[model samples]
Target chain A: MHRSYYTLIASLPHLPLHFELDRTPITRPRLNERLKLLEDADRDVIDQMSAFLVWDRQPLDRNDQEVIERYDNLMRTVSNPLVRALINTRINMRTIVSAVRRRKAGGSPPVGVGQWVDHIRRNWEHPEFRLAGRYAWIRPFQNLIDEGAAREAQRLLFSVNYRTWSRMAEHYAFSFEGLILYLARWEIIDRWTSQDANAGQQRFEKLISETLGEHANLY
Target chain B: MDESLLMILGWTGIYGATALGAVGSIIGCSRAGQAACGAMLDVESGYGRLVGLSALPSSQIIYGIVVTMTLRGNPLTAQSAPGLFAVGVLCGIALLFSAAFQGACCASAIHASKNKPEVFGLSAAPAAIVEGFAVFAFIFALVVAGGIPQ
Candidate 1:
């Protein structure tokens, strides 16, 4: 039902309760409006990532999930390990009505930590599913990954506050720096200066197009 | 008919009384500790970067001693020193119970620190410091009562 995401929207002070309630199936128009907002947000992530790779003189491709995953695997980072993470988790939980509103309207953690966890499960589907997607991104990982490794991947989802999937949802919940660095680690971009080049961009076009666009199609 | 019989009886009372003091204070300390840890965890959630387990268990120790003194020692001395004993015992009881609850506050700080290890490192220090004042008052009463010339 994708309850949490729209539930949050419905609760917005001036937003129509129809967005969360009214019990009607989501219409194509509403979905389109949401997708447009999402694409705009996604483009900002791409632009920021492209700028970072350019600044670092590294190759990047926005369309390839594998490259994105590769870059993401490398550029892994964490900031404000506790409060920022808690806030990020709260946002993921759909606890923050609007980061903007919260700052302007006094938002707080929605209800409970357990509720936050439940919200995360609902949005991402399941940690196992997210883990499967991540595993599938990195090829030749065929022979049953260690259960612990799978668990670690799930933990990293929260550890990284699921910034990757954070974009998958309609809400764009992270900063430019955060998004760029996160995308960079997983190598999801199409242009890189190359592992060896003075000015040549690695043109990971296949990587970027595959990850963001095709991956969505595969699942 | 020897003083040995009196000494055995007296020491047994002292042991029994002190044990009760210890148990009550222990519960207080446990509650205080949980509260402190909870408060700390809520604020910061820094998994492995904090320390304060010591303070969590200290208040009860002080409470036990005070209880021991008030419940057993004070009356013996009261016979010898009349009005001095009553005032001293009165002060001791107040000090002991205050310390017990104050310990709960420190425990609360501990609880908070546990969840959010980033909480002030040795967090909510001022609360503990206040509790320390009450403990000191407790100690002073214990000291004064002990000197009542029994």
Candidate 2:
């Protein structure tokens, strides 16, 4: 047994075990890929959270039904409605004029973002794109002023909403409030980048840029 | 203070201080432009009730120059009124330089404000305080020059 052990040890090469790929076929995407998904989800989260944060649930009018249907379809296709809505909204963020230009230039607009927004009325629908709409409506996270009595209530609601929504995702579980914390991070990052002009946002901006590839100039 | 000397002090200080302030105004203008870009980004979602976020500093430089020039000089001194003159020069120059520097600082504050747009109002307080010092200096110079025995 000792000789056998000695023979085994002697037979072993003076190299790392990792170098000898035992052909372990670990099937799946990588951690970075997962992270990228998370990052994309995060952008979606930001978009949906923003809609909730800054929009009112005024129902879509008669002319706006088509847009709403598309939005609903997009939202339903993804596992999480809020995340899906957020992602779709963010992905489609084009300036109103540019959106107009694109629409006119393209001749017949496709089933993408522009078609949905154009038909919506301001009273029933909330449009995030600034140059396209007359009014900008954002549903601030809390109904009551933070200075008033319901500060804790607001905080609790924020968390619960985020946690619940996040849990719906296959990998990450997030609630509404968790969504807020993520939003807060986004806001802080936005503020930091804005103020610290020298400190370039290679990571966050690059992620956003990639996410926005063709529509980079939308905002 | 002698009358001729008073004239020399008043005009010279007024000219020098105003000129220095004018130089500061130009520098401040450039800085304000940089600050404005960040401001534009921030104002994307926020309320911008106040109109002069970028142009405000340029106005300050103008105010400094005007304040310096408008000061009353001692009537009696044909000669250099050393006390009256020194006060005018020091105060004029002080206000001018300080205002200019404050303009640059204001631009920076505006830039800083882009991130935390909610606290843009906070920047005004510090800038106001600094402006107060310049105003104090200017007012003092005016008072001293006016009090000089012609």
- What TM-score is obtained for chain B in each of the predicted models? 0.50, 0.70
**TM-score between model 2 and native:** 0.36
lDDT of 1 by residue, B24-119 (tens): 456545555444333332334442332254245455445545545563644443233433434444444544455455554455445444444467
The CAPRI classification for model 1 reads as: incorrect
Per-residue lDDT of B66 in model 2? 58
Model 2 has fnat of 0.00
lDDT: worst 10-residue window of model 2 chain B = B42-51
Residue B56 alpha-carbon offset, candidate 2, angstroms: 3.2
Let me know the DockQ for model 1: 0.01
Query: Pick by TM-score: which candidate is best?
Result: 2
Enumerate the candidates' DockQ scores in order. Answer: 0.01, 0.00
> Candidate 2 residues A96-162, lDDT tens each?
3223333334533233344334443232222233333432212232223333434343343334333
| Regions of candidate 1 where Cα sits further than 4 Å from its true position | A1-219, B1-24, B35-51, B54-57, B66-78, B81-92, B114-116, B146-150
Question: Which portions of model 2 show Cα errors greater than 4 Å?
Answer: A1-219, B1-10, B38-51, B59-73
Docking class of 2: incorrect
